[model samples]
Target chain A: MEFNRRQVLKLAGLGLTATATPGLLAACSNGKPAAGDGSVKFEGWDYEATLVQQNLDKFTQASNIKVNYTPITSAQYVQKVVAEFTGGGGPDALYVYDDSLAAWVEGEYLQPIDGLPGVDEVYSSIFPGNAEAMTYQGKRYGLPYYTDSNCLIYNAEILSKAGFSKPPASLEELESQAAKIKSMGLLEHPIGLPAQLSDTWWAWVWGLVFASGGDLFDNQQAPIMNTTDTVTKDVLTWLQNAANKSKVLDPASLQLLPVPVDNAMKANRYAFTIGARYALRDYNDASKSKAAGKMKMALVPSLDGKVHGTISNTRMYGLAKDTEVKDDAFKLLTYLGGLDANKQPNTAKFWFQERGLGFAYKAMAKDADVLASLKKFADPAIYAHLAEIARPRNVLGVAWYTEFETEMHKVVQGVLSNQVQPSAAVASLAQSAETLKKKYS
Target chain B: MSVLTERRPLGDTAKAWALNAPAITVITLLVAYPIGYSFYVSLQRNNLKRPKAKRFIGLDNYKALFSDDAFLSALKVSAVFVVVVLGLTVVLALILALVLNERFRGRGLLLSLALLPWAMPGVVNGLMWRTIFDAKTGALNGLMLQLGLIDSYQAWLTSSTGAFLFTALAQVWNTLPFSVIILLAGLSTIPSELYDAATVDRAGAFRRFTQVTVPWLLHPLLIVLILETMNAFRAFDTIYVLTGGGPGDATTTIALLDVQTVLTFTDFGLGSAYAWVITAITLIISVGYIGLLYRKGNFEV
Candidate 1:
């Protein structure tokens, strides 16, 4: 059909308008929202994405507030988040790790959050140390959500078959048992310890250090890396001894920890591993495990003939200093962190799976399902193990821990590989620690 | 009437200015400002982990980069990667293009199929290759062993040499397709009579190719080579996804170092300094490539 001049002009104008609208809208909305309802745009990696969303939904349903979640990869999110903050256009709330909390808080990028409503409840319910992980400059900047600590996981059947009904009570005894299991040719390593940069590495080291009465740092906060009192030396020596000296564990433990764990429990490669509680959860989730019900949790072996001292790491939530709606954000935070938050079975399960974060909530920790699942897959003594030694250390700055550990990893790996002697490795670690003290300071 | 005509000329100038104004403004705001800010950041001693510790320490970051072991390794990796990837891509693409030029039964299908790898996203390609190279259950190891080509599964990512080899292969796969397509377009432009004349002179296929096809395709090949080289130099996603620059820093590139310095370590000043160094290196290579190409008479006709 032929169109008139007016119709043609009208269609042309419509096309022009459509093409121009987005640009115009972007120009208009550059500094403000179009709807006039002030909205804060938060961006970060989605460690507990859907769970955070579900909690946000709950908060919204309870109160008329909305949150827009922008998820990026962990490393990318930090870069972009810093860019945003530097540009003065960052998200009001973000997901951050402990390593980042100190830096951000020290930078004044985070608001002091201890005074926020329901945060106190979070502080008490989640355990003090978990909250302390998010604290910097003597103020809490994040609310604790879930925490994790390590335990010794052993195959009960394997232990029983080796003529032991219970897991080892000391590091020496643990080694003896490991030797027995190793003699049976059932495993490449009796207690699978991955020397990789995971919670296990820190846990294993920290347990030995704390139990042996070795302080990681001196009173002046100078890094005491090579002291006889420091467990760093003992832990490294023990691992080397186990793998290289005794041949109780495989040499590849220098590369990975979970590999040994997976091989032992799931693939029937070993009888035991000193791993995180999440490993138990992982065991139950894997359908290929032939020794699921046969496994049990125990306190990680103590160095000084006491229960192993554990260090717990928690995933916490903090209100962004730049958040447009701090009150509402706190409500969201509170709702997610509330005692009853995990009461909803689905929400509790969501918390467990999304972050692999253990609960700070005693009730949730002792929940029948949680306990049953832990008991079903974990060695028998793990909960008690966590209770005894899974305390948080507020002394080491989060950022410092990573730097210290990274340097220590080189030393540990060197010792394990026989590239360096224990004393030489420790001496170098001391030097590195001194360097980090300057760098971090 | 003359005044009116003059007014119209002025109006045309005004119209031209208006058309270009927004673009100029956008370039200034988006590109110029960020570059300026990044430069400013590069000169400072800033830490994202400790934002309160932002201090201006000019050239310290630059000085530090010269001493960083990771940065040096990354620089070496990037240099090797770019040169090797560019060389491999150009040669492989030329062969593929030459093969595609001749009329075959499934030429159209083959050409389209060849483009599929290029069409896939970088992440997908990285992940696909990662899966293929998986030590435990990878198809590559399984197939190789089944075919009696190897006795045991190779840990392609764990060993330094193996990781480097696999990473380079992944990069070549990602980049070679673009080279092929560009070279093929150049090949299509070459007169068939030139090839016919070469053949009539009793020229072998290789001689005919080198004498006739290459000179004609030189310009396109240079463009392909330079662009792919730059891309390979900045290859982050594939390396990030596949090896994570790991199995002990075997695959870490300059870009990954810049990212880790900035984000993971929260050392913004150092990161920006590393970034600036990368940009400088890239610019130098780009300029060098252009100068060499021009000198070699690739741009003459």
Candidate 2:
């Protein structure tokens, strides 16, 4: 059977066409739902990925629903996930930072979970502030993954050595104590606060502002922190004084993010700092820190020394709008964030017992196992009280908040560096917020 | 043999095109399409978070950039970074190339050592520099303290000037090796007789270098200038890791700003505009370098 030249050419053409057809067809198919494999795709920032996978496996075993888990670097997670969603392919269920919820919802990347099964029960179980954080435009979109507030963390040994038995209750007291510690040669900079231009920085800033009883925006969402008498200006002034006049704030704080700040605390380089309440567990871990068992948490120091308020931040499990397997995805979400079939907050309990992670569920505060775990690293009473007083940021649900937060980082940096005056920075930030609001509107 | 003869129906140009078709197709898909799409995106308001707001705004994004404080500050910062890094790199690379060109002991080892920085990823280089210059536990502070340079550790990266200079130094270290390799190749091709003739003319060492070495290396120098200029303009990873355009926009290059605009702010149109401006600036600079170094379709020398 000798083939002629024409027949060979015809066969080659047919083979080439066959080889390319599938790829061409796939390229033409846009916005198509993923294959109905009954598997839910889940993504979160890289934090204890091993534990997350183990938990996911547990869910799979118990519920018999497949879950594909992906952990992204915390620094790149938001942008990478947003890009995936914009390109019309993303996880069915994903961890969503409260700050990004409004923007994501506005972009139509996330669907409201108000109608999902057990949604109301989950909301009722969590703290009201946490529930509010998971809602945007009066619609619930997620269940709380974790909730925490920024507190004043102190190195007790350093404070004791510096002749202080208790933590400072006011910003002035904190500055004076830090200066004394610095003067005693106990530490070059006795205070550490994250001022790096990242999400952590903005969170800490909001915590400070809230602790001082200042609001970034009013009920109408108009910028109100620019006023001369506002606590926002006072907080900036205190930071400026600490960084420049008193020289008590670590200069390296300008370059440090949350993780590095925690590391610095563990190394006992900072006598005091503003950090998440959850970090206390890591701070007191003997295997991980030299300053272990010497760290203590106190209410965030405020201007008046009486009103100790701080910003409560929540991370939630949200469902993507384009997800075809909504039921399976919601099951995964509930298993991770809400409750198990036994109506137990198993995931929340696991996170708390293992990592000292704060929970949105109020019942966890009174759970005997959780209380016993809290005793190992933290004071249960102080932790519970901090949560009771913690309020979510009013601007978290604004579509333009992220852009405004970026600008605020730069302005605060300028203030810390003494490049811009505190009042000037406040005014500039307020102006930036106005511009972003108008742009988004 | 028959198949080869059968291609006679196709001309040489068509045959060449057919052979190169795969490469051309890849370039069109990977390179040309992205560039064209970026330019198209630049003319519209394409914010991912504000999808409904997207529309053809016709150069409004570019117009807004000139008035944007962050963009302007980034431009100034980029200019400083490029000028300082390029000037330092060119001089250091030429000196190292000249030194390496001479007969020396352990020349191969030294050459290999010089390229170690180039072998490293940009992020690693930035991290290395950060550790060296860290305010609290930096090796530089320890070394300086041992030498009595200061009584206590100084915060080197806290100031705008310090951050800019150190970041520029890191860029120079990462880029100098490639420039040295190019100049070394150029040095190898220089005729020995030219130097001998300069010596016979009683030209001094400086005069010989200026008259013989520089003229012979003009084309290579031009290549280094254009490449380094473009690299310095668009540098992101190292700067991002090192300073993150921080301590108040001290190190925010246009590339970093573009990333923040597009990824952080999700404003693609403005980011694309920033990217186009960078490309335009880099192209103009490359053209200027060529105009200065080349004449009559050849090196001026």
lDDT of 1 by residue, A1-441 (tens): 999999999899899989988987675453433323645455557665666667667667767777677777654665677666666666676666665677666656678876766566656765556766777767887765566777777778888878898888777788888898878775546765565433223565665565455666764556676764556676667776876777776544543545544755676566767766776665655575776667666776766556457667766666777566777667656665554453443444457645445766655566666666555555435564475466655445655555566556545655665656777877887786776667667
Candidate 1 regions with alpha-carbon error over 4 angstroms: A1-96, A113-128, A157-221, A226-230, A237-274, A285-291, A301-307, A322-357, A361-381, A391-441, B1-7, B10-25, B189-214, B298-301
Top lDDT: which candidate number? Answer: 2
Which residue pairs in candidate 2 have backbone atoms (N, alpha carbon, C) closer than 3 angstroms, thus clashing? none
Q: Candidate 2's residue-wise lDDT over B1-301, tens digit each?
A: 4555544488899999999997999799789999999999999999998889889999898889878888899999999899999999999999999999999899999999998899988999999998898877899999999999999888787788988999999999999999999999999988899889999999999999888888888899999999999999999888888888887889989999999889888889999999999999999999999898865223332
Report the Cα lDDT for residue A22, model 2.
86
* lDDT (tens digit, per residue) of candidate 2 on A171-207: 9999999989989999988998877666443667888
The prediction achieving the highest TM-score against the true structure is 2
- What's model 1's TM-score? 0.79
The window of 10 residues in a row where model 1 chain A has the poorest summed lDDT is: A27-36
For candidate 2, give the docking quality class from DockQ: medium
What are the root-mean-square deviations of the candidates from the true structure over C-alphas?
Answer: 5.5, 2.5
Those runs of model 2 whose alpha carbons end farther than 4 Å from true positions after fitting are A2-17, A24-29, A199-201, B1-9, B296-301
lDDT score at residue B3, model 2, on the 0-100 scale: 58
